[model samples]
Target: MSDRSQLDESGSSAGEAPAVPEWLRRARWVWLGAMLLGLLASVVQLADRETLVAEIRERSPELSQQEVDAATNSGILFTLLVSALTLMVVLLLTNRMLQGVNWARLVLTAWAGFEVFAMFITAIGLAVLGRGTIEQLAGQSVSAVELLAQVLVTALEIAAIVLMFRPEVNEYFRRMRPRLRRR
Candidate 1:
């Protein structure tokens, strides 16, 4: 039989249906939740323009008023651009993950791994330098809501990674692989 004849209407061959497990479906929603939390955190940070400018000024005390203003404007613009790009990436990856794309899962897992590693490094640096040094450098404390949101986002990311690796999800990916190759 021809390869084209083997594929059903849904694009899977014969008996294979692109059936996503409940865990993967839940993982997709968790990813969406994480994305929303991230957006909230970004918005909260962006909303405090005065504080952001004050921190920038504090760090660069020697800068003239005009220079500081210019820097603040540029910084806000950069932040907004980055936030928009991040949102787009999160949406794209979440959609692909829902479609049983193994590469998307791996990419997201790698991103989470990098975030964990960066957190570890920051913690170690803070521990080595002590709280006083950290406070001096940071110039301000993170709000409780922001901290909670960050924690929730991190937990959701870890949960999604774990869910994507479940036996049924893994099997689904495996079954989809050959079909993808044929196309």
Candidate 2:
């Protein structure tokens, strides 16, 4: 049989599907867990409706009560929308990366880098201003559950990044590159 005839729709040889390496599989799960934890963190933050309203009011003192309520509701809606979109993007990128799409791995790496940078900036800001400033800004204290979730998500992302770039995973992607390009 001709080589072209032996290739499947996915560009793999014949009926064989690409096998995902353990490293990539573990990385995918860790990354997905981080996303779920982040969503949970958002839910925890939104649990305090009074605090949300108070924070909104404190930030915009000139806003009337009606305006404050509107802002609070809009903020909640916006957060939900953004969180949902973020989850979808993460799912797509992780799925593609697992399928040996090298570009997807790079995109995920960039996202992890961005998250690390953001966390660094936040840490420095918190340290410089101290805890009192955070309470003042938010008009309330941060919940332990939210803080725990954020920390766990950070750790999980770091783990995922490490796992995704392991030697075997890199080799797997390398082997798949030519096959994928032919399609």
TM-score of 2: 0.84
Q: What is the C-alpha local distance difference test score of each model?
A: 0.77, 0.84
- Model 1: per-residue Cα lDDT over 72-122, one tens digit each: 788778877887788789779877877767898899899877766755665
The reply for model 1, stretches above 4 Å from the true place, is 1-16, 123-129, 135-145
**For model 2, how does the per-residue alpha-carbon lDDT over 55-99 read when each residue is reduced to its tens digit?**
787678999999998988998889888988999999999999988
lDDT of 2 at 34: 95
Q: Candidate 1: deviation at residue 130, Å? A: 3.9
- Global CA lDDT computed for model 1: 0.77
| TM per prediction | 0.79, 0.84
